[model samples]
Target: MLYYKQLKVLFLLIILKSCFFAICVAKIGFSTKTPYEFIHPPQKNVIEDDWYNAHTDQYTCGAVHVSAVIRHGARNPGESDSKRIANIHMRIKDNIKDGDKFKLLKDWTNQFPVNNNKNLNDAGENEQHHLGQRTARRLKSLFLEEDMSAVQFMVSSAKRTEDSALAFYEGINEEIPSEAPEEFDSEVNDENLRFHTMCQKYINSVENNSTALKEYKVFGSSDLINQVLEKVIAKLGVEKNVLEPADLKTMFVICGSEMAVFKFSPWCDLFDDEDNEIMQYWSDLKKYYKNGPAYRITWEQSCPLVAELFTIMDDVIAVIERTEEDKDTEGYLLGNMMFGHAETLGPLYAALGLFNDTVPLTSKNYHEQKNRLFRTSEILPFSANIMFVLYECEENEELLNDEEEEDDNPDDDYRIQLFVNEQPMLIPGCKNLLCPYTDVREWYSDISDDCHFEYLCDPHKKMHNEL
Candidate 1:
């Protein structure tokens, strides 16, 4: 009787473990999908006073500066993807199995029109608008002035990014309802935001190199992925070899894109949890080699952007450390916001060593790296951003509880917090959300001092600070 009772308990535990694991891994992972599903907007916190999520222990005297790098909102699939969608649509008629779920796909015409690929759909626009509103609400101190001198903004040349910036601007005024600037900086070019495109080494080593995407390509051709593709074709009743890996990828892409625009998509039903994980790894591998830590040139090319961010921080620190009599505020700006693409944030994250996996990603380690930290669905989704908030952490009795007071240092007057997708990113050296500025600067200094755009991009060129 005791043995039977133990066995029953073990079986129930096993069932519960399986159910929990299923819920954790592989739920709709894609860049086009809104991150709000995975990371909820900080609506409740925005209404509160503290900069953090109601953790009032932070002794933030005032915010000195803020810098953010935001990716454009959800965009339509590219031209090639639209063609793939049409191709799959053409094949579906003779192949699709009849069911209530099949009703949508069978009667569906492709919503994507020619030349509509790069533009922001209505969903994309709304994402950025809310982001802007939230940002403004969270940092009200920066927008209180009528002069509008406190804030600066820039964007990539891409029309989607420009439109995103405009939407963000509109959202900001909705929150502050003040005399905000009518225009963002129109002169900041691709060299500042899309530096990878201009970088010769990045181009030669990753972007244009046929062998650069070897890992991603190899993974796509693996038995695991092939089996998934075979099942997809079988389910659709399409002929064998009719759908290539790229076409299957296009199916996933269309599913994510349509799901972002509309609340639901029939294309999404073609993929199961396992298929979702497989597709995620496939896309992540491409980003890893092309712009992540897999290739040195991938992150190394982001030198200029990193350098620019650190230099601004240095100026703010100088102001913070100055004595009351000798104080000066010549170069300090309250905020800077720049809008770019997925290419912009991926390389920057790598340069900062934010989400590096323990081992380099490979086809053999696909399953092993299932819990890897470099997943982009959470980091690079539509309207995703990486922001640095510098605060003057004046020593206050309120900041230190009885246990913390003994070790507190008055000299630690300034602190910094890095936010990713509107949450404080857990940096290795920092203890919590707000960390010592000096310790954070130590991690930042080497990258900032070493980057010379002309020198790193092309060895033959002389080094100069064009940034």
Candidate 2:
């Protein structure tokens, strides 16, 4: 009787422990739905009569060149099966009994590698197609169908980038030519063509005199540098005899490398000082490249591009300046604008001067913009309109007309204006939090009267709404 009682007590204890464990797990995993919860709500409409009226005069003002640095459509960050394999491996390592068996399982799992595949998964493919269609439609509305063919194309070599570009061309029924012309060759190889070009330009700027190297202390010795220069020239495919100037206008360059390389590049190094700077940059870059660090290389590399993109505004201003000065050049230029991305658009936004300001958006906000931009898992998705304007500044005149003004008194500045999705918005004040979704949310809430949410709750009302 004593033995039986002891056995019953043990069984009861085990049962109670199991029940407690189950409860704990349930608590950890379970979540309650709130009344105001929304999965992915519809974004607010940005186009209004005010926005249309502002640009109405420019419709027939001739050709304009638009260069968009777009984030690629929706995609699984890494290989699709990575998570499943990781979960299984983690479980086996944690729960398996034998040390040898665990080692064997780990090796087997690790042996199956993950990489970007050209033939994207179902979600990626869909994103590509949808984005392509949307891009085509937008182009049709913005420019004559015939004009799209003339616009130069440059896309990153990543599978998604190519996929996005292809889908875009297909949607417009633009012929996918076998190859772009040699003059427009923007494909960057591993040999560092851009760096080499910059080096050559730097050398030429100094009149090829080695003594001039004293000015830029960062550059190494110039005596043997000529030999290095020869190698750089050969590697970059630059003919030493050719005297043509570097073509910086009307050319598109698409650079794609593992995020790791971008972090370690000289450009990133410039931002950080010596001592721990190089190591810190490498560590940060590697973290993003190895693990999923959300938007990494795209943002870091975009800073310089943003600085350069400002030149566009400067060009627009120059046209305005020319108008002010009564110069002979055409006052305006217009063309179809297209950009491709593989993931988050945070980098694109960062490169566009938005990230440099105070109070930038966060990664969470960026993710929200992703859902809003794609609206589906389809590849090659199109984002809302991004409008840039250059207004002529009088010697002492206010930058904006009273109705088109922005808060923070942006109108009082030099008058370079940027609009996302046709809304006059402020750039986030900080680099760390420049997430686009937060901006979208704020914009949506601000203009809620103009945007109806009936489509979010009712399946029947969820029809495609386009700009």
Candidate 3:
């Protein structure tokens, strides 16, 4: 009897081990085969139209300075990305057995426009034009007399960004023709705009540190993802061995890009709400781990940008403070424009603590995605912009009422308002959307103190191995 019981126990252990191995394999295969499914879709062109329609706030005190950090306008996919989509489309056409899914993909890919490079498309041109036109109109009082010298522009190294800057200039000229510079000094600094390339610490800790994002990897292969993958596989009538999540998402990417450019795609209807929510969570996971509140160093990566903004604002304030008697002072800078990619823009927004989830994003909390605050589609869409408007509010009403000659200074009354994508944003820990300049300055000063370039770049560095 004892010998028989031992044999049964050994057999049970073997079965359990085999089952565990199979589960591991399935999870591994899911992650390895469907890498693209987790990547967020490129910026949609329609977001530009949305911004144009958003109501602009009329400043009661008047805006003396405007700063805009913007994502470049819409563009086509790169050669490799397009090739992947094309291959997936061809595979679905040749091998997909399901009638509905096959027909849907066929109709969608048939209408999908082709582009082989990342240059700005016609829609991109219109998007940038609209941004400039709308911004110029809002600040029309400041630009009543067109003087390009009052404005400054910083563009990234990419050709698309350069073209975007030019397009925006053209748009401003549409309304205030003389305000747009014929061509002034524009700096192209990849160091400040593309800090990821230069920040070795960020690359090591966030980009290359596989161990740091183990939760993300586990979440990607969780039961929730597996169930969604199974649903997608069944919908397409393809065996698990033959089809992968990456293949399906590539079709989705093409569908979304086509729809954004041309305003419609049949493939958009292929996925139900469940599938979209799962895929969006996947993208959110990557973003959260790579450059968001989840990582301690993510915000530090954007210190240079925050510092530069303060420097510009300080210079402007110094000029404003110069006595009216000082004729040597050139008028304070009215506006400054910057154009860059979402890779940098996303991190900058993260540094500002925008859209942070109250609950931690973990595998255990994956089901609570609705409450997870990071939404890539809403934050990093094409032509997304973060604008800082410096307002000069009415100052010293008591003194004016007392019939005094006036001791009020615009610099003392200056306040800063934050706007994201043409809509006002109320910063965390602040009472209102419009915050006092001193409060903003103090907040940034603290960030600057914490942002020691050497320490941020090399968190592990130690002088005496002391805390």
Winner by TM-score: 1
Q: Rank the candidates by lDDT, best first.
A: 1, 3, 2
CA lDDT of each prediction against the hidden true structure: 0.73, 0.31, 0.65
Off by over 4 Å in 2: 1-65, 76-122, 125-141, 172-301, 316-424, 428-467
lDDT of 1 by residue, 285-330 (tens): 8887787888776777777788878777777777655644465545
At residue 162, give the lDDT of candidate 2: 52
Clashes of each: 0, 30, 0
lDDT of 2 by residue, 1-467 (tens): 23323444553453364457435221110001000001111223322222212222111121233444443333332554444445534543454444453243334332213664523333334444444444333334333423444443445545555555455455444322224322332332211111112222222323243433232221222222233334323433335532111110000000001111111111111121221222222222221221112222223333233433444544554565467568676644332233444222333443343423232223223223322222211111223234343332222225446665343432222332345533455554422211222233243232222322222223343222110
On a 0 to 100 scale, what is the lDDT of residue 113 in model 3?
36
Candidate 3 regions with alpha-carbon error over 4 angstroms: 1-60, 98-101, 107-117, 179-181, 396-411, 449-455, 459-467
Off by over 4 Å in 1: 1-25, 31-38, 41-45, 52-60, 94-101, 179-186, 319-323, 326-331, 397-411, 459-467
| Best candidate according to lDDT | 1
**TM-score of model 2 vs. true structure:** 0.36
Quote the lDDT for 111 in model 1: 71
Q: Assess the local accuracy of residue 115 in candidate 2 as a C-alpha lDDT between 0 and 100.
A: 65
